[model samples]
Target: MPERGARDLSPGTQARFDRFSPTGPKTSLLTVPGAVGAEVAGFTPVGDVMGCVVHQVGYTETSTWSADRIGQLADILRAGYQTALDRLVEEATAIGAHGVLGIDFTITSPDGLVQEFVALGTAVRATAGPRPRRPFTTGLPGQDVAKLMLAGWVPVRVAVGISGRAFTDRWGRPMVNEWVGNIEVPMATELATAVRTAARAEFTREIGDCGADGGIVSDLKFDLWPVHDVAVAAMATVIGTAITRFREGPVAPTSTLKILPLTRI
Candidate 1:
């Protein structure tokens, strides 16, 4: 598996790895305060890293777009995100970093059918203590990472959930009345709810897959557009960092902020 992972790296990425030296000066994307906070938490910034992928989406059937089609769309999106993230992790590993922090994702569709996903972050190495088998990844800022350590928890990885849907069934055909007065559309409401629920479920599954105790949701996004002027297509995304307990017993609270289950929104 490790060999396969290494083989998957692009030539450019491999060159980046070959040029990296542990004793050389490093670049970082963190602010001064963020760097200080990470240092206080026993980590030293190694370098800035990025990973990206461009995907082409194609539909097998060209009839009316439905929820089933949306499922395939979501699958393609999920693959793009995972591949990009995996490359990001590989870069961190090549640089000898124990983790990547303050990670952020960007997605853009240049055309109607082609999408690009990119992940960026600052890689860090532990100044002391044991490291995990694989480098951890997180979207938390440096200060937040420090606070989490003080609270006896450590970030595992970034978790993502995405779901897309289109409404074209019996309940959705009436939303296009040209002469009807403006009013709330039940079909739209249902579509939103369904997509959100599916996305959240996927997020939970991601957390579980990483063997984390729970997750801390960092963002939620939704997009909707009219499909052929007869149906509406919607996509929902949830992003968060999965975390696990490091200390056996309860630790002192880092702040007065409530410490409810991070998995719960």
Candidate 2:
């Protein structure tokens, strides 16, 4: 047997131990953002985040159902709707949003087992300040100046997809086509919801990391594609500019700001 010492161990054993142990210097836990830091500091906010939830329910058809069973069908529909809404609300609460806006719900069920449901909307903090109004100068000619007005932000593209078992029709007929057309509406809505959620999370993370209040989302677009015959994928991108505003007491002569026009003649 080899002599045992505090600093002496088998190379393989040491390596394995090191691999299993957490590595790197321990960092300050208070530096973590969101609730992590709050927990460490033993502080809690006065109110909960405000947010909205949207729910979509897909159609379901059963041969056993008759005109007499319309009440049962309605009950089933209500249950599905509530489930989707609850899910959306849960997600928004997790992210600490103050409230949700424009909650939209859609449902489409071409087949019984493949019901599609979607809920979406904006999540915002009730305490957050209103967006500042910035006057944009339009250099249109006098002849066209009267008709020109600032247009609200618009998303350039939106796309969504889902992947899973193949969908069937209301009559329990499996769709032979690789693509199901009836699902487009609900799928798209849900895709938009997910994309927007991701985008907002990213924006919030960036704001916290950079010590900024908030940023605007513009030129947003969404894309959806099929990963498999049954699996779908969706993405949203915001390519516009983000501006950070600071309180009035800044005196930095060396700081340079750049502004670009959206259009040029």
**Best lDDT among the predictions, by candidate number:** 1
Worst 10 residues of 1 by lDDT: 1-10
Instruction: Estimate, for each residue in 179-231, the C-alpha lDDT of model 2 and write its tens digit.
Output: 75555445445655765676556545544553433444434445554432333
Off by over 4 Å in 2: 1-64, 128-265
Q: Tell me the tens digit of each residue's lDDT in model 1 across 1-265.
A: 0233535568867776666666788888888888988998899988888888998888666574665677788888899888889999988987778999999999899787888999999999998999887899999889889988987899999999999989875653655676887876677889999999999999999999989999999999998776766678899999999999988646666788568787876
Error of 1 at 57 (Å): 1.6
Clashes of each: 0, 20
Instruction: Tell me the whole-model lDDT of each prediction, alpha carbons only.
Output: 0.85, 0.35
lDDT of 1: 0.85
In model 1, which runs have C-alpha deviations exceeding 4 angstroms? 1-8, 248-265
